[model samples]
Target: MTPPEHGILGRVAGAVTGKVVDAVPVEEILEHVDLDAVLDQVDVNHLLDRIDVNRFLDRVDLDRLLARADVNALLAGVDLEDLVQRAGIPDVVASTTGDLLGRTLDVARRQVVGLDAVVTGLVDRLLRRRGPAPLGPVLLVGER
Candidate 1:
């Protein structure tokens, strides 16, 4: 039969339901229930499909996550030698140093050549010898 609709019986049923609900111990009822059994009846994939992932992620606290990280200990765990080897830093440094040493030697060689030229000019002036500073170990007719 249909439930009572808007009459003395409906009012009386409402009053009785309210009293019964008030008298019931909801906490005790919950304690008697098996949560695993309830969960087994749930459709997890359907629940996941209904969830808004981006909205859920927006509620995450990123600062609190970073605060839990140990940065100093993380750095201490790194292998610097392995890192340098992987990056080929030693080869780069060796090539750069080799180029620097070569340039330095070239500069020193040029300076020594300039000093030799100056000494040759001075000797030619003193001996009254002219003809292009005696030209590489070959003596002129006026000298031995």
Candidate 2:
């Protein structure tokens, strides 16, 4: 088959297979094949045949979906004042708290090989410390 034809077939197969996978119970999917095998082998065209496209499309609201995404919520929670404080540092320093932490780790690794850069770096980091707000905790949730 031509490359274009192959690509189209792949997309169709993916859509159908995805639907089939979603509709099938998790236990039944495992009975047929492991998760990876089922994901790799299921044909999307077969899935499409068993599901209603119009109904599926009707159930999806693109705007509402994007609004519910975690990244958007995180961005909304960002405090401008906290960001401004974090951005300021002593003139001699060339790093943020995260950058200093990474640099300190690198220095420690080098020290293990008889090369030390920790003392000066630590002093610089201390001098550059800006009282920034505490970052909020991240919560991870599994699907029910």
Predicted model with the maximum lDDT:
1
lDDT (Cα, tens digit) per residue for candidate 1, span 15-102: 8768867998878767878999999999999999999999999999999999999999898989999999999999999999999999
Task: Point out the worst 10-residue segment of candidate 1 by lDDT.
Answer: 135-144
Error of 1 at 45 (Å): 8.5
- Which parts of model 1 are misplaced by more than 4 Å? 1-69, 138-144
Residue 141 deviation, candidate 1, in Å? 17
**Considering only N, C-alpha and C atoms within 3 Å, which residue pairs clash in candidate 1?**
none
Overall lDDT per candidate, in order of appearance: 0.86, 0.71
Clash tally for model 2: 5
The C-alpha TM-scores of every prediction are 0.51, 0.21
Q: After superposition, how far is residue 130 of candidate 1 from its true place, in Å?
A: 1.1
Candidate 1 lDDT score relative to the true structure: 0.86
Where is model 2 more than 4 Å wrong at Cα? 1-33, 66-144
| Tens digits of per-residue lDDT for model 2, 51-117 | 9889999999989998878996677989877776687744325557668889999988877644333
